[model samples]
Target: METCLCPLTRSFRPDFVLIRQHAFGMAENEDFRHLVIGMQYAGLPSVNSLESIYNFCDKPWVFAQMVTIFKTLGGEKFPLIEQTYYPNHREMVGGRLGL
Candidate 1:
């Protein structure tokens, strides 16, 4: 059952909603991810869960989590997590070539 992926419509009614997969910025799901999240908050059940979806959506965070888990399970006493985390995400977003 194919449906429009933009503008977050409430025209469809299903027994349970399973919003499993969606690309963050693609045209097919540019604004659709937000709808799934809203629906999830508004008492809809979603498969593959928003938590799982967001894991892969954030690559650096995935790396951080995986490294922590690996260090925990493998008993490696190296510094897996650093205390000094940059607190300015908005400050990094600019037109300059800071990349």
Candidate 2:
């Protein structure tokens, strides 16, 4: 069976690295757009929700992967919090889209 690459897999050391590496490889490949579209077709969100979960929980490894993935996808800067809002918009967006 094919394994699902989600944030929960970070609990497993080797598997987490493997998943991150696989994602990085996909991000670097020429056919990455097709790959991402395929993943979306398979119900994987454009952004990985697991990464947001890890960020909220302050898991270093997962956070690092999130940063890397964000940058790889052309998000140059990290998102910032806005005090005017109650719930964090970034988190909300990430959660809503399952990213």
Candidate 3:
């Protein structure tokens, strides 16, 4: 993790960067976010901008944003998303959820 503070660009200077597959729900990836920050500091643009990358962590937030956008394009058969949140393990163990 410490090694990636900044890339040593003596050998290769990338014109652009594409960061992906860093899945969410990972506490360790917080450091990876720092790497992204450093890259942003260097002005190295990416296919997925840093803001979107950060947004990927919160699924409900993303769903809400999508719902907002989908609401704009009115139609009878527009994709209707019924959001159902699952209970945590503790809640499930306590019989909070029947299913």
Which wins on TM-score, candidate 1 or candidate 3?
3
lDDT of 2: 0.42
Give the range of the ten consecutive residues with the poorest summed lDDT in model 1: 90-99
Each candidate's TM vs. the true structure? 0.49, 0.20, 0.55
Q: Clash number for every model?
A: 0, 2, 0
lDDT of 3: 0.66
Write model 2 residue lDDT over 1-99, tens digit each, in one string: 999886663332122221232323323452333444444456554344444433333334455566566767654466622222223578555544323
Question: Which of candidates 1 and 2 reaches a greater lDDT?
Answer: 1
Query: For model 2, what is the alpha-carbon lDDT of residue 6?
Result: 69
Candidate 3: tens digits of C-alpha lDDT, residues 1-95: 45667866665568997876553555754546666667778888889887777676677677778777677875454675566544566754665
Over 4 Å off, model 2: 1-58, 76-99
Predicted structure with the largest lDDT when compared to the true one: 3
Which pairs clash in model 3?
A: none
If the candidates were sorted by their TM-score against the true structure, best first, what order would they fall in? Answer: 3, 1, 2
| lDDT for 47 (candidate 1) | 57
For residue 27, give model 1's deviation from the true position in Å. 7.7
